[model samples]
Target: MRRWTPFVLLMPFQFIFGLIYSWGTISPAIHVQSGWPQATLDLAFSLTPLGLLPAVILAGRALHRLAPKTLLAWALTCFTVGGGIGLLTASPVAFMLGYSLLALGVGAGLSTAACIALVSRLYPQRRGSLGGALLALYGMSSVISAPLFDEINRLIGWRPSLAALLAVYAAVGWLAWAFLPEAPAAPGRQTAPLPLMVLLRQRPLRWALVIVLMATPLGSASFATIGHLTKAIGVSSALGVLAVSLMALGNGVGRLGFGLLADWISPRFSRAAALGLNALAALLLLGVLHGYGVWAFVAYPLLIGLAFGGMAGKLPALAAHVAEHHGEAAFGLLFGAFAFASFLGPFLSAGLGMHSALQGLALCALAAMGLGLAVAR
Candidate 1:
């Protein structure tokens, strides 16, 4: 078990991301099929982040009630069952309810508690790279699932495509139940008081919050808007979808590649570099609005995916550094607080009037980049 710890640690995240996160790509399709105008569809897509607010606030205590393995198993079952419900009905409202339920389970179960807790303790030196690698694996599921879901739709239909997704979730759950390790409870507040105000008073935490607020909106907006940008820039819908596929692939690559890169460079450097890339990515995205032809399709998502990946890869290391520096006793509380920022990413992106949000996104990314460098120094 010790020899296989890393693999076991990462399995739960891979499953959760594969099911819920991948749906961003499918969101437009859901919108079109459900007859909800693009506005409603976008709103529904952003709900996961809204719902995550309360869920992340309470997640540490929720994980304490059961072993991480038990909690993960139950979470995966909820995800599978919710996905199965999605298959049973075609009503857009029904689909929204089903996906939201899955998203809720994902938010609670996939918190920093399990993987971060386990790996940071077991392999403290490698936590950054390991966490990044795990996130990358999560990204891979999106890459693979995007095209697979498309192919599944082509062959069986969306309903069965969802049913198939349920099977995958179930299989991953069983693997988690069978293999994920149970860590000995570390010294900390077993029931840490949620310090909503502590974060407000702490300068370091406030800085971390600013980073997430910036990067997450950048990460999510790029994801949400890439399809629209492609079409508006004159790529056909077919090509827009193709660009989305590449974006997903790039997201995974960013995670894995940058995770490894973080191992080599200082976490501070890794973060600053990520912020810089995000600024560049934002410019590329803004350029697309000017009609860059097929080149825009290739350039924008690639840059966005890379910057988004950099942010994802750097987070675990950043969080772990704060935890170790402040006192591991309060790690869960600190991590949960940091996660609250992740919960805001999608809403920030969508808040930009659906038409010109990219400009706002670029501005936000630049602000985040500047903050990251300051915080690192």
Candidate 2:
């Protein structure tokens, strides 16, 4: 039980923060209830990653100055307050602000950088597998939350259901706070931190940046507008929500599965394979756009979700591998850089129509695969 404390305590927080991925479900409801344009609702989703970038940097720095538990407490408070605001107000601006506030809390408290840093300290040798497991739960959050929220919306209404969801998140956050351990202290003779400019100049980090930029856009587009895309393709709205849930399921499985593969084989092989998966997903999306048939409705989401999860699971391990001597601080910086690049997808998707967005995603995936293969060599 003591050995498992980190996993037990942290998993819940990851799940709660993971709810951010369920924006596909939430955005559609907002569109239906408020009659907001799809693009405008997508802007709300895009704001999350934009907001997260700065908060992650702040949290990474604060980890040295404050207790992890304290940061997490603040995260919970922000998320709950944001949700409460969303519940009380119907204004789109207020909703975007509320979600942005939630993004800040997630970045500052329950972020991947913070979690990976802590877990790496605890299980340095198994960081790849452990990071995969942690993020697998993160990907799965949408799988569980989206349909649950959709049902709640059906039974009551979107606003009330949101309040209930936030209430549960608050309870879970408190539980995680009570149980999560303080991060272990650093070694007495620590190496000096690398300058950001120097770190960015390294070969592997550059490749990691390219990979993140290429892979994230498709997943971002799907996550932001899967429900709308499904409906546009003639699927029922409920089924559209279900497709998002299934996509999330695939995302979780891919994370867990691909993370284990990285541990078993090599990070390079695992990443290349994941990029291949992304390329395949992109090709399928092209077929879907051409009216490939009903199978695409099921297939595209699962494949893209898998590719997305694979990228998320593998990238940290890749960073750790490339910067083994620099330690977790360096890993945090690398991950932060990757996170900044990842925001492009949702922002791009927000402006483009669905068909054009899919075309762009295919091009992005193909380009990523070509670059990834070259980098692997």
Indicate which candidate wins on lDDT: 2
Q: How well is each residue in 22-48 modelled by candidate 1, as lDDT tens digits?
A: 666566556555566777666556555
Runs of candidate 1 with Cα error greater than 4 angstroms are 5-9, 24-40, 61-66, 84-91, 103-112, 187-194, 234-242, 286-298, 325-355
lDDT tens digits, residues 1-377, model 2?
79878867878778777777777688788788768898687677667666666566566555555555666777777777777675677787887787554643354334666677667667776777888898888767776788899999998877788778878877887777787788775432244456567866778776777677777778767866787788778877778878776777778888887877778888888888889989988888887778877576677788888888888787557766665555444555545554555576656665677778768878889899999888884
TM-score (C-alpha, index-matched) for candidate 1? 0.80
For every candidate in turn, the CA RMSD to the true structure comes to 4.0, 3.5
Cα deviation at 330, candidate 1, in Å, is 8.3
Q: What lDDT, from 0 to 1, does candidate 1 have?
A: 0.61
Those runs of model 2 whose alpha carbons end farther than 4 Å from true positions after fitting are: 28-40, 61-67, 84-91, 103-110, 147-156, 186-192, 225-245, 287-298, 330-342
Number of the top candidate by TM-score?
2
**Model 2, C-alpha of 43: deviation from truth (Å):** 2.3
